[model samples]
Target: MSEITPDLVRHLGVLARIQLSDAEVERLTGQLDVIVDNIAKVSRVATPEVPATSHPIAMSNVFRPDVVGDMLTSEQVLQNAPDAADGRFRVTAILGEEQ
Candidate 1:
């Protein structure tokens, strides 16, 4: 097990721009030691055969057959528009006259 010293915690506090009282430093030392020990335990359990994975289950692409279907005519699409011209939808000018 690795030991976490008060001086290390004090230095970390300075680097992180955080202020820690003596009591906090003493408490954090034990806490940090436990965290490091737990990580080491996990590392020891890991093996070459155990493949690394971000997710638990295997995944594959789910897709449907590509079948062409009926499409709408230009007039059918433009029928609902408030304003249309030359087989297209028209809108008010957004830019000022400066251009």
Candidate 2:
């Protein structure tokens, strides 16, 4: 098993440009050691016989197939607009932007 020491934590902090006190370095060392040990345990159990998977359960796409259907014409759609011009909907200028 790999060991996570305070010196290693301090070196990581330096690489990450983070300033960690002695107390923080000591605390992180213990936490990282636990994490590393747990990963090692998982590695031992995940053998060649067991297939690798991203999720615990099977997953698949649940969406319906895309199929083109009847669509309204541009004039038909613009008929309901409060204001339209040049075959398009016209709205007031926003954010002081030029047309």
Candidate 3:
């Protein structure tokens, strides 16, 4: 079991960029001590005999066969555009620099 003191909690808060009060740090230190101890016990039980499995259920590649589909005409593709010019969608300048 690891001891989580006020200093440890304060150091952790600094690393995580969190501002915690003295009272909050003290409370968290106690809670973190218990959490760390529980994790240590769990780690001890996880032995080499047990094969490491990333997921609980079996998974297979869920993919669809690549096949060519119907194509759309240039006029049909530009029909829904709010602003179109010269068979292309006309959009406002996205950058300050001139193209």
- Report the C-alpha lDDT of model 3 over 1-99, residue by residue, as the tens digit: 468888999999999999999999989999999998998887998899988888999899999988989989999999999999999999998888775
Candidate 2 versus the native: TM-score? Answer: 0.68
Considering lDDT, which of the candidate structures 1 and 2 is the better prediction for this target?
2
> What is the alpha-carbon lDDT of model 1 when measured against the actual structure?
0.92
Q: Report model 3's TM-score to 2 decimal places.
A: 0.72
Q: lDDT value for candidate 2?
A: 0.94
In model 3, the Cα lDDT at residue 49 comes to 93
Candidate 3 ranges with C-alpha deviation above 4 Å = none
User: Which portions of model 1 miss their true places by more than 4 Å?
Assistant: 59-99
Total clashing pairs in model 1: 0
Candidate 2 residue pairs that clash: none
lDDT of each: 0.92, 0.94, 0.92
With candidate 2 superimposed using the best TM-score fit, by how many Å does residue 33's alpha carbon deviate from the native? 0.7
Candidate 2 residue 35 C-alpha distance from true site, Å? 1.1
Q: Write the per-residue lDDT of candidate 1 for residues 1-99, one digit (tens) a residue.
A: 456789999999999999999999999999999998998888998889878887788887799889999999999999999999999999999999996
